[model samples]
Target: MNIQDLRYFHELVNLKSYTKTAEKFGVSQPTITAAVKRLENKLGTTFLIRDQSHKSIIITRVGMQFDEHVQSILNELRIAEEEIKQNESATIPFGLPPIIGRNYFPTLVPTLLDKGILHRLNVIENGSYDLYHLLLDGHINFSMLGLTKVNPEPGIRLKIIKHYPMNIIVSKKHPLAHKKAISFKEIANENFIGLSSDYIHTRALDRMLKQSKISINTIYRSPDVMVVKSLVAQNLGISYLTTLSITKHDDVVSIPLLDANQPEFILAAATRENHIMTAKEEELWDILTK
Candidate 1:
C-alpha cells in the first residue's frame, strides 16, 4: 500500500470512525473505506472490525499490535522529511585534516555552493586520528583525512578519494634541494619539521625511521600544516608532507622520496559506518570524486 493508504488507516484507527477519518482529510467516507481495504488486501490481514447493523467500528486485536509498528514507520518517515528540510536550510558541519582542507575545500565548497546543495559549510581541521573518532562519535557529518595502516573503529567507514605522493620539502638553499630524490637513510642527519606528534602522519614517519634505527632531528612541530611548510621554507629543517599540502612558494621545493611501487599519501572521506548519503552528503561526495 501507499503512504496515503497508511495515512488513512492510521487516522481511522485513532478516530474509530471512517466517516470522521475521511472528514479529516476532506475526502469521502467511501474513499477512506477503499484505502483501508487496499491496505488490508496488500498485507493480507484485516485491521478493523465493523458492525454492519449499528455502524460501529473497532480495531482488531491484531490491528493494535500492528498499529504500534505502523506508527513507528510513520514517525520515522516524518522525522526523515524534517531532517531533509533542515539539512537543506542549516549549516552542515564536517571535518578535514588541515592540508586536505586547505588544498581541496576552496574548489569543492564553492562547487557545492554554486549547485545550491549546501547553504553553508562548517569545517573542522583535525588530525586523522581525531577526525576518525569524531565521525565514529557522530560529532561531525563526514571528514577527509589520511588513514594509516591501522584499521579504524568499528563504526567509522572510510573511502579513498585520492593519493598524493609524499614529498620531502626543503628550502632552495638546502643541499638536498638539488637532488632528484632522497631516501630515509640519507636524511638521517637532517633536521625535520613535522605535524604534531599526535597526528597519524607524524607517527607513521616516526615508525618508519625507527625501523631503520634512524632518528632525524625534529626541530619544529605544529598542528597547523602551514607552520610545518613555513619552517621548511625557512631552512629550519626539512619536512615530509603530501603534495596536496604544497602551495606556491619561491623559497621551497617538494621532491619525491623514492620507494618501491611509489609509496603515496592516501586521502579518504570518513563517515559513520552505515551513513546513508542524504542530498547534501551525496553532493559533497560527487564533487570530491570528480
Candidate 2:
C-alpha cells in the first residue's frame, strides 16, 4: 500500500528470496517476510509460494500479475525522485529558435553558470509554427519568435519584446546596396533568397511583394537566417530579413524598404500564460529585453 511496502515487494520478486531481499535492503529476513505478508493481506492475494525442500520462494500466479503493476509503480516512483533531483540541481529545460539561441544565449550562458543554474537548452531552427507546437505540447518551456497576429491558446501568454523591421539585405558589392533605401517594386525582378514558406517573415514578405506587383525569382529557401545572409553575400540572391538576423554581419548591408506599408517583425517572448518562470529565466528575459 505504501511506497516502502511496494519497494519491498518489488525487490522480493526480483531476488526470489526473502532472506536475500532483506540483506540487500539492510533489513532482517523476518522483516521482509512480514512486509510482504502485510502487502498480500491488504491486497487479499498471496504473492509467493514456498518450495518445500529448499524453502526457497517462487512467485505465485497472482503475484506474477501484481508484479507487473508493482514494477510500474516503482518505475514511476524512481522517475519522480529523479525529477526532484533535477529540480533541486537547478536544471531547467529551455527552448529557443536557433538563431536566437546561438546569437544571444551565449551572453546569458555564463551568467547562468555563475548563478549555478544549469540549462538544458533545446535548440530548434524550425520556423515559428513548429516552435509553437512544441511549446503547446509542453515539450519546451518558452520560446522567442517573430510576432504574428495569431492568438495564443488559453494558458499561453505572449509579450512583445521588441519591434524589428524587415530589411532588404545585399552584399556590399551588389548594386542595390548603394541605395540607402529601395522600394519593393524596384527589386521585383531580382533573384531572392528567402525564409521557408512556413516562416511568418516569409509570409509577410510574400504579401508585400504581391501588393507591389513584384515578382521575386526565389533561388533559395531556408529556415536559417544566417544561410540566407551568407547566400546573399555570395551574390547568389538578395533577401529580406529581420534586423536581428543581420545585426552581427558587417559584410551584408540591410537597407530599409521605403514603402510606408512595409511590415515590421515583432520579436516576442512566449510562455505558458499561467506557468511560472524561474528566477534566473526571468532575470535573463529582463536583461535581454532591456
Candidate 3:
C-alpha cells in the first residue's frame, strides 16, 4: 500500500524468505509479516501461499502480476531519480580496470573533486571486460579499459591514453637482471609468475603464446597486481606486466621482451556511442584525455 510495503514486497518475493527479507532490511519478521498481511488485506487477495507442512512459500498468479507492475514502477522511479541526479550534479558512474599501469585515473579522484568536475563519482573497479560491458549497458557513464586494435567492443568511443607495453620484470639479484632484454623463449626454463586468467592482459598473453606455440612454466599465479610485483621483487619468480606498472623498486628491474605480440594493451577512456557529455563530465574527460 505504501512505498515501504512495495519495497518489502519486492525483496520478499526475490528473497523468498520473510525472515531473510526482514534481516536484510533491518526489520523484525513480525513487521514483514504484518506488512504483507496489510498489503493483502488492502488488496483483498493473497499474494503468497505458505505451505504450513513443508514450510515453503509460493507466489500465486496474482502475486506474479503484482510483482511485474511493482517492478516497472520501481524501475521507472529509479531511472527518474538517476536522471534528476545527473542533471543536478555530474553523477558519473565510472569504471576502472584492475590493472595498475600508466598511472590509471582513479588515483585522480581527489583531483576531480578539487576541480569541481564531479559532484559525485560512482566508481566501479573491475576487470576490463566487465567494465566494457558496464559501459555498453549504460550502467556507467564512462570507463578506462584495456583495448587492442583488433576485436574491440562495439558502441564504445574511446580515446587512447597510452599503449601498455607488456614487458618482463625480475628481481635485481636475478641472473637475467643485467640483460637488456630477452625473448619469451629465454625464460622458458625459468620459474615464472603470471597474472590470473581473469585479467584481460593475461588472456591476451595466453592467446598470443598459444598462437606462437610459446609455453611458460608458471610456478605461481596471483590476481593481485601488488602481490605479483612483490613476488617478482622477492626473486620468487619472474613475471610480465606493462611498463606503466613499473615503480622505482630497489630490487626489481623491468625489461622488454622480443615477442612479436607483446600483447601491448591500450588504456583508453570509453563512453557510449552518441552520448552527450555534461559540463562536469566533459571537464573530467578533458582531465583524463589531456
Candidate 4:
C-alpha cells in the first residue's frame, strides 16, 4: 500500500528470493516478507507463491501486472522529484543541438543577453534524436529538435519553426562538385560518409535511399558533423547533410538534391505536454521562437 512496500515487492519480484531482496534493501528477511504480505493483503491478491524449499519464488499473473504499474509509479515519482529540484534552482534546462546551435542560435543570443537571461540558461548540447528523449524524460525543459518529420508522441508537444533542405556535400575537387544539383540515383554507386543513426540526417538519407530504390556504400559513420565534413572535404567520400551545418567558410559544396520529393531537415520547438512556463521561461521561449 505504501511506497516502501511497493519498492520491496518490486525488488523481491526482480531478485526472485526474499533473502536476496532483504540483502539488497539492507533489511531483515522478515521485513521483506512482511512488506510483501502487506501488499498482497491490501490488494487482495497472491502476488507470489513460495515453494517448500523457498529457494525461488514464482510470480503469479497478477504479480507481473502489478510490477508494470509499480515501474510506472516509481518512474513518475522520480521525474517529479527531479522537476521539483530543477524548479527550485531557478535555472532553465534548455536543449540545443549542435547544428542549430552553430547556425541559428546566434541570431537569438543578442536578444537573450539584452534581456539578461543568457546566464540563467543551462544548455545541454546533443544530437536532436537524443535531445527529444531528454525532453520526454523531463531532463530538459525545452529543445530545438532537428527532425525529418513531425510525429505525435505521448507527453510531448512539437511545433515546426523552420525547415532546412538536406543536400549532398562534396569536396571541391570531387567530380560532382561542379554540379549545382544532383539526384540520389546519380550517386547510387558513390562511396558515402554518413552521419550516425542517432542523427535525423541519417534517417533522411535512409528514406531517400528507400525511395530511390538504391543502396549506397557507406565508407564511414560519425556522430560529429565536423568530422563528417572533414572526411568529405578530403574526398574520402561524399556526405548528405543539412544546410544548417554548412557555412560559407567550409571548403565544401552544398548541392541541392534534385529528387522531386526530397526530405527536409525540420526544426521543431518541443516541450513537455501541458508544461506551464515560468516568467523567465516564457521570456526566453519568446526570444527563441521569434
Misplaced by over 4 Å in model 1 are 1-89, 150-152, 260-263
What's the ranking of the predictions by lDDT, best on top? 4, 3, 1, 2
Backbone clash pairs for candidate 1 read none
Clash statistics: count for each candidate:
0, 1, 0, 0
> Which residue window of length 10 is worst by lDDT in model 3?
100-109
Candidate-wise lDDT, in order: 0.76, 0.75, 0.79, 0.88
Candidates 1 and 2, the one with greater TM-score? 1
- Candidate 2 lDDT over 1-290, as tens digits, reads 67888888888888898878898989898888888899889989898988979979889989989989988777656644644554565654455666566655676677666655544443555567778776665555567777545467876778877777888999888888889898888887889888887678878887887789768898879877778888888888788877876766457889998887777777777776644566766775565465
The model with the greatest TM-score is: 4
- Per-model TM-score on C-alpha atoms: 0.65, 0.62, 0.66, 0.92
lDDT of 3 by residue, 164-214 (tens): 787889998899999998887777777888887767768876766776677
lDDT of 1 by residue, 98-203 (tens): 7776786677766877878556567777777887766655556678877555366676676777777777889988999999888767889998888886576786
Which candidate, 2 or 3, would have the higher lDDT against the true structure?
Answer: 3
Distance from true location, Cα of 271 in model 1, Å:
1.4
Per-residue C-alpha lDDT of model 4 across residues 200-244, encoded as one tens digit per residue: 888888889999999999989998899999999999999999998
Please identify which of the two predictions, 1 or 3, would achieve the higher lDDT against the true structure. Answer: 3
Candidate with the greatest lDDT versus the true structure: 4
Which whole-number lDDT from 0 to 100 does residue 117 have in model 4?
86
TM-score of predicted model 2? 0.62
